[model samples]
Target: MDETLKDSKKLISDIQTQYTRLSKGQKLIAQYILNNYDKVAFMTACKLGETVGVSESTVVRFANALGYSGYPKLQAALQELIKNKLTTVQRVEMANDYSDENTILNKILKGDIDNIRETLEEIDGEAFQEAISRLLKARKIYILGMRTSFVVAQYLGFYLGIILDNVHTVRMDMGDAFEQIVRIGEDDVVIAFSFPRYSKKSFQLVKYAKEKGAHVISITDSLFAPIASESDNTLIVKSNMASFVDSLVPAMSVANALAVAVGMKEKEDIKEHFDDLEQMWDKYGMFE
Candidate 1:
C-alpha cells in the first residue's frame, strides 16, 4: 500500500500540496480530477484525457508527477480518496453525467456486472476469512443496516441466525434497536452495512456499538467510508449507479457470500441446525 492509499487521508490534499510544482497540463488534469473526482474514478485515462482535451501521455505524465507509478495506480488512489466522500446530490449529478451511454437497462446491468468485478478486485480474501473466523468465534453477533442497506443486513442476519443462535439484528424501525445494541460488549461482534448516500444514522449506530467495545466489521463501498474507518475489519465492496437507486447487487452478494462462507466453515453444526429447521419448517408449512 502506498502513502496515498490511506483511507483517512484526502488525495486532494496531495494534489494541492504539489500544485506549485505541476506543469500547465498536469495542473489542468489535477484541477479537472479535483472538480469531478467521483466521476473521474470510474473513467479511463483515455476518457479523462478526452474530457480534458489532452493526450493520454499527458495524463500519464500528470499521474507520474503526482508521485504515482502509473495512471491506474493514481486512479486507484483518487478513488480511495473520494470513494465515500460524495454526497447524494453529487451521485445524482455524476449519474446524469454519464446518462448519454447505452440504454437504461443495459447500462444498469453492465454497471452491476462491473460492480461485482470491482468488488472481487478490491476485496481481500484474507480479510474475508478473518471475518468468518471472528464471526464464528464471537460470543454474540449484531448486524445493523439502514435504508437500502437494511435489506442486505436482514438477508445476512436471517441466514446467519438460522445457523448460529446468538445472531441479532438491530432493527431501527422497530424502535428497540439501541436497546439491543446497548448491551454490546467486548466479546460481541457488530457487522454493519453501508453504501452510497451512506446513512448517518447507521454510521451513528456503528459508533455506538464501538463505544460499547464490540468488534465491528463494516461492509461498505470503500475504505474511505466513515463506518470502515470505525470498524475493526473493513470490507470494501463496489456499487455503482443504476438510475435513482444505488446498485446494491455487489453488496448483497458480498453479504450472502460471507454468510455461506461462515456456514461452510462450521459445516457440521450448521448442517445439523438446518436439518432441524427444515423439519420444523416442513411441519409448519413455512414455505409453499
Candidate 2:
C-alpha cells in the first residue's frame, strides 16, 4: 500500500468512528474533504474555505482537530492521497506548470505508468474474474452509462457485440432506455456506470433493470454511489482528479479487460467469426 493511501484510509476511518464528537465547523470540513478529496487535495486553503463557506482559520482548526499540525500538513497528506489515487493524465496535469510542453509530456508518461501500476494493485482479481464469468454466462448484456460515461458504454457495446451477439448500449434517449430495459429479464445482466455528481437517470435505469430481474453490475468511484447499493457487483474505479474533468482511462481499461476476457472465454466461437471475416476481407480486397 502507498503510504499516502494508508494515511488517508486511517484518517477517513478515524473520522467515521469519531464523527459525532466533531465540532460543527470541523464536521463541515470533514464532509467537504470526504466528498471532494481530489479537490481538497489540490486546492489552496483560501479556495477550499471559499467553497465550503468557512474561514481560513476554521479550515486550519479542522485540520488540527484531525490531528494534523496545521492546514498545510493536512494539505500535504491530501496531495499524497491524490497522487496515489489520480490517473496518469490527471496527475501529469496536476504536476505540470502548463506553460512547459516537454515537462508536461514527461509527467504525463510517468503518470500513465503509475496509474496502470496502481490500478493493478487496487483491483480485486477474484471479483473481476467473477464479473467476467457472470457476463459470459448472461443471456444478454445491457450496458448503461450517461453523459461522460456514455463513451465507455459505446466502446463496450461495440467490442462486446463482436463477441457476445446480445450486447446493448443504451442510448441517451430516455424513452428508448425505459422501453429497452422493460424487456430485460432474469437471465440478462446490466452493467451501469456513474461517478461523482452521478446521473439521476442512470440510477433510475439501474433500478428498473433490477426490477426486471437483471443482475446489476456498477462501475463507480464511490461505494456510497447510489448505483452501488443496488448492484449485484460493483467495480470501484478511482476517478479522483485535480481538475473538473474525471479520467476515464481506468474505466476504459476495465471495459477492455472484460471484452478480452469474454472473447477469450468464447475463443472457438470468436475464431470462427474472425476466420469468416478474413475470407470476406480477402474477397473484397479490403487490405494489402
Candidate 3:
C-alpha cells in the first residue's frame, strides 16, 4: 500500500470524531469538507482554505492534525473517497470549476506532467524489475483492462507481443472475460491495467488469475487499488484526474519503458524477427 495513503472512510470518520476538539477555524474547514467532500477533493490547499474563509496555513494545520503528512495527502484521501463514485457528469461539473477554455490546455498538460513526475518519484524500482523478470520467464502472458483502461492495456500488449510470443490481449468483444483467461496456469503472467473508476471485471479476472497460480502484475494508480491487492507485482503509476478524463500518459510511458526494456533483453532475436517481418511486409506491400 502507498505509505502516503490514509483510508478514505477512516479519514472522514476521524474528522467527525475530532470535531469537538478542533479550533474554530479548523472546525469551519472540517465542516466544509464534511458536507462537500466531492468538491474539496479536487481543491488546492489555498483554494480550500479560501472557500472555508481561512488562511491556507490553517488548512495545512488541519491536515496535519488529522495525521496526514500534509494537505496534499489529506486531499488525496478525499479523492479516493469519490474516485469510483463520481459519474461522468460529476467529473465534467468538476472540470468546469477547475478550468476554463482559455486555461484548459495548460491545466490538463500540467496535470499530466505532474502525474508522470509523481509516478517516477514514487514507483518501486525493485518491483518493476521483478515484473520484467516474471514476464521474461512466463510461458504465456495475458493482459486485461476494461473501459478506458483498455487503451493502455492494448498499447502494452501490442508492443509486448512484438517483443515476446504468446501474449494475449483479452477483449470482451471476443468472449466473456473469464473465458478469455480460463486457461491461465502457474507459468502464466497476467498484467492488469486498473485506474480510477476501477473495473470490476478486470479485478475479477486478476483475482482468478491469482487463484489459478499465475503471476499477477498490476499497473494502477495506487497500491490500495483492488487489482493491486491480487497482483504479485504492483506497478504504481499515477493517473490523476485531468478534467473529465483520467490522465493516461504516465501509464502509457511506463508501458513503453517496459516493452523497450524487455525487447532489449532479447535484442538479437527481435532483430532477426523484425528483419523477416520487413521482408514479408515488402513482398505484400503492407505499407507505403
Candidate 4:
C-alpha cells in the first residue's frame, strides 16, 4: 500500500489494489465494506465482523491489511469518505445503529469531548495566527456560512463586529450570498464556516473571494474540505455527527477563540465601545 495516499477517496482504490493478496476472510470484510461503507463506517468492528460472517480478529486483520494502524483508524477513514455524502435519513439510521437509547446521552457527550480534544491536537497554530493577523488588517471582514453553519458564522460575526468596526455577516436572507460579497476585494477577508454536507454557495463565495485577491480563511473539519483548497488559511475543527445534525461544539469554540484573539489585540478599543454601549443601555433601561 502507498502510505502517502491517505485521502479517504483513495481508500477504496487501495483496497481494490490489495484485493488480490487478501485472505478469504479479509476479502469478505472488504467486499461488505465496499458494498455498504456508509453503514459500516458507523459500525463497531465486532458488528462489522458479524455482518460479514467473520470473527472480530478477521475484521481487525482486514483493517491492518489495508494499512491502517487499527480498526478505529480504518473506521475513521470510512466515516471521512462518506461524511459529506450521507443523506439526513442515512445519518439518522447510522446514529440509531451506533447508539443505544439507554446510553445515548453518555455516548453523545463523550463523542463531543473526543472531537474537542482531536480538534485541539490537530489545529494549525500558524494558520490560527495568520487568520487573526488578516482579520486585524482587513479593510472589511465578510463571514459566510450556510445552513447549520450559519449559526456559527453569526456568532463569529457578532463578536468580531464588536471588536472591529468593519465586520459584515453575509445575510443570505437579504438576497443572494454572492450579492452580499460582490464587492469583496484585496483588502477584504472572507471567513467561511463549512462542514460536512458542505454548501455550494459557501464554497463559491470563498472561491470568488480568493479570485478577487481577498484573504480567505476557512474553518472546517478537514484539510481535504473543498473550502480549504480555496483558503489563504485553513483552521481544522473537529465536528461530530449527532443524528441528522452535525455537532458544532468544537467549531463554536474555534469561533470564540478567534474572536477573543482579535479582541485581545484591540482590548482598549473594545473596552471603550462596550463602555459607551453600557451607558446607552443603562439610560434606556434596557435591562434590569
Taking all chains together, each candidate's TM-score versus the true structure is 0.83, 0.70, 0.95, 0.95
Model 1 clash pairs? none
For every model in order, what is the number of clashing pairs? 0, 1, 0, 0
TM-score of 2: 0.70
lDDT of 1 at 197: 72
Better of 1 and 3 by lDDT: 3
Ranking by lDDT: 3, 4, 1, 2
Which lDDT tens digits does candidate 3 get at residues 93-112?
88775556759888888889
Per-model CA lDDT versus the true structure = 0.82, 0.78, 0.90, 0.88
Q: How many clashing residue pairs, candidate 2?
A: 1
lDDT of 4 by residue, 1-288 (tens): 112226477999989999989999999988888899888988899999998999999999998998787898888888888898988887777766455665887877888899999889888999999999999999999998999999999999999998898999998789888888889999999999999899988888899899999999999988778998998888988886877868899999999999999999999999999999999999999999
Candidate 3 wrong stretches, greater than 4 Å: 1-3, 98-100
lDDT of 1: 0.82
58 Cα displacement, candidate 2 (Å): 16
Specify the poorest-scoring 10-residue window by lDDT in model 2: 1-10
Candidate 4's TM-score: 0.95
